[model samples]
Target: MNQQNVRNFSIIAHIDHGKSTLADKLILKTGALEQRVFKDQYLDNMDLERERGITIKAQTVRLPYRSQKGDAYTFNMIDTPGHVDFSYEVSRSLAACEGVLLLIDASQGIQAQTIANVNLAMAGNLTIIPVINKVDLPSADPDMVREQLEDILQIDSTEAILASAKQGIGVEEIMEAIVERIPPPEGDPDQPLKALLFDAWYDLYKGVMILVRVVDGHLKEGMTIQMMATGHTFEVEELGAFTPVPKRIDRLSAGEVGFVIAGIKKLDETKIGDTVTEFKNNCDKPLPGYKDVKPMVFSGLYPIDGDQYENLRDALKKLRLNDASFTYEPETSAALGFGFRCGFLGLLHMEIVRERLEREYNVDLLTTAPTVVFHLKPEHGDMVVIDNPSNLKKQDRTDTILEPYLRGTIIVPDEYVGVVMNLARDRRGIQLKMEYLTPKTVMLQYALPFSEIVFDFFDHLKSSTKGYASFDYEFLDFRASDLVKLDILFNGETVDALSMIVHRDKAYYRGRELVKKLKEQIPRQMFEVAIQASIGGKVIARESVKALRKNVLAKCYGGDITRKRKLLEKQKAGKKRMKQIGKVEIPQEAFLAVLRTDVK
Candidate 1:
């Protein structure tokens, strides 16, 4: 195929705004799949994505189309995830495309993530084609959505196409616009081979399957390619494109998207944003790789069965090949034994990873409470980065604590602005800006601590706004604050996995609430178990789980007073001895008690 006839683009939108659906319609319109074999969310092949109704990974497909003008063209489309946690995936996909179809829901209008993705596409200098989706809905307001495109997005409303992806409407117009508006890739096919590695995954039989967008020259099956970042070379075993399904091709020319199997066993060798070039005739410089993504939330992932530690490690390695954003390191906890301290983009990202590990790898995992990174400046030494609360030292040695903050954006209905503001204020947020996108919709910006956003913030925002609010955020600089490590103790022993860093003022209140929650979760044992929330050496709150009574007195219904007294004394002595050595079994729910409490 001619490079001039190839159009590389992606579909970007807010969650559930019809990105996958639109991709399906385009693929179907091109006769890429038979009607009987076609399915919804055709590009979302992962079971986790299909079950959750969200696209976690970006998927690519090549479409063969003949325009009404009788010219044949090839459409390479990448469908990207919309959730803020998966924004990195969107950025990677955008890097491989020449344009993006910015899909907006007609009924919902603009959202926080929609703006975030638009900024990403703009940053990449890609052509943006505004498409008003779900126009056929009963409550859809395409006219209002068009006004939003003009006012909020600063895009020409007249050029915006209104269509319903679910009903297969305006598929032809979208295809035509993609061809006419998006410029063809400019690359010399005669030049040396140079391609950008956007994504890669581990394969059982084929080893590492890398997805690349050719920028300069051609890549063939027998060519030897080098990863400029790793300086490793390998002979390409296979070259192909996914026309909804994998199709073998003799050569992938410049300005094309395809996969390459090079018998590379380790995924680390094929970096996400590295440059792939010919070994003997490589380009002068490598393409600038993607910025490293820092994880926001950290938690401990321990196998329920301790022997599966190796299995868990293997599972995490394989998962990392698919998701380059999350990170993990070997860690040990006194209560949970050996585990990996995992970092994720957000809570949802953490949940998805845990689920994939459990379902796909058949490993039962015990996940601890999520926490954000904090910078602690010791009075005697240098600043230390702390991800786990258990790492915090005594307050006397710490001069100051700095916590990460976020520049958060929330879009909601005008009527819910007051409630949303109250929610932010409760989370110690400082208002940055607020404006009306229209007479009915409002956009709010705030500077919030990353710790507050990690737990229940989204849940609270949705509940307070009646599920009308859409929120997104980016990391800002860390700021000094009055923070302390709140620890949970069972039977007078501290549980490392249950500790967390919190603001000093709220520590006492949260301590009381946490102890109460843990009391409910900790079952009664043979000996009375004491649950305490403490700071340093001082206990702020405490609760007791009463020991299970055996009723020695019940067996002495007709006994004398002396006999009853002797029996009671024996029971007390036995309980005292048992409390000295008996261990209190803390359930998994007890470790999650921190999340159930009102930390604010």
Candidate 2:
């Protein structure tokens, strides 16, 4: 059978560029989804994805349809994460396909992320089919974006497809281009089973479901399969392609994309981008191309309700089953109680996962401000995971510690270029590359120490750019620099969670801002609560707010026994929520509230 009839393609675009919306239109046009009830970004199944108007994880769906010429083809439509944090996820998604439908917002033109997506597509050696989406918008400029892509990516602009994914316009042409341009899977069908596990999920009823792109032979129900990476084998029970909804099939053949539910039940067993084959008679060599996703940004995720620890653990396990990049482990804090130390691909990825856990699982969590992992060495030659800034006990020795650095890129309007450059220098960011996207926009590259840009950098960038700047970063190893551990003291007692690693030069400025933000977020207690940032015994900054000592007794409700007792009980519960810092019992919001702003 000829494989040319199949088209394996993924949609790539910047966040809010209508990539998800475009995917939905394709799903509707191909009859994969009902046309009458078709909604926007319908392929993003998670609640967080819908709420954020972004795709945090990659998803695949099969849209089987006939072309205008009456030629039948199976379009394995895939969607990728839009943020740079999930760059690895994007790469894996691209690897599983032969072509990408590059969706560019007609109004926004080409952003920083659009270029990143195009670079990944070129690296994968996939054919690029540029689509100018959101044509219905008043600011739509398809021709302008087409020229930009052509000049930047060096690809032909004449083939660009202009469409409004919202109204389902020009979707057919995009699909037709995929069929005409993307080369079909080219491998021997009779060879032993060799499939790539680009992504997988665990269903409550179906066990471990592995999403595989078959390269050779076929996978059938009841056939035993082996994961070469883990040396684990399981019997296939269910197999089918996701239609964005579950659709069961008896078997999946070579060059086809579908999921396999082997009696495998655990996530750790089925590795992402790993190889799978028929057990006993499996392929002699494992399938090529498998790379693990590395975590760039990390933070501690603690349960707000300490009693719900088990619920939190189960929630994380469930989340991990579907997401290979999200990692966590049980951890405890002297201040925030018990929680898990979670690792993420990036900040946005961390935010999406946290949001999903709260919304989908109904689990409320207290996430410690996001932190990047840093490499540190001591005189004893001990290696430690320095996740929290407070964990670092600063000594008089300067060369004893090493901190993380980030290779960052910022793309902004050309007018505010000087302001951004000055701000970067203030934050200890070193300029590396400057490229003119057009006469109006310039992309600035920087090599900044992670400690300098970890906090408030995102907000400062936007402020400098007047909201026209977008930034992305990757951790580029550790370097020794003048650094210090700044501690936050509440009511003369140091709050362990609020301490952070900062540069020695900017300690006073950071201390003041952090203390101020902490004071604002943390509510008053029975005794006066004083928020202070200190280096060793010296107080660098301080903010004090008097506590409400008479809150409970003053607001006494004179009622029947039931109502009166309930009021007392509520007061006691409220008191319990407050964490005692020195002489004051501060509310939990103080710890959580400071995370909302940039601490300025």
What TM-score against the true fold does each predicted structure earn? 0.97, 0.89
Clashes of each: 0, 1
| Residue 269 shift from truth in candidate 1, angstroms | 2.3
- Candidate 2 per-residue C-alpha lDDT over 1-600 given as tens digits, one digit per residue, 9 for 90 to 100: 357788888889877788787887777777877866766777787777777677878889988879789989998888888888777778888878889999888987888788888888998899999988999999898878887987777879898989998888888888888888889877778899999988776677877778999988888899998999999989888888888677998877778889887878776787777888999778978766656566656678877777889998888887786777877887777778888888887667787888888987888887777777765676666767677676777565633567777788888889989998988898788898999978887889999877666556877888777888888777777887777778888767777776777678878987887777777777676556778889977998889876565445455556567766776688666655564423555555666544554533
lDDT of each: 0.92, 0.79
Best candidate per lDDT, number?
A: 1
Question: Which regions of candidate 2 fall more than 4 Å away from where they truly are?
Answer: 379-385, 396-398, 547-584, 593-600
Worst 10 residues of 1 by lDDT: 391-400
TM-score for model 1? 0.97
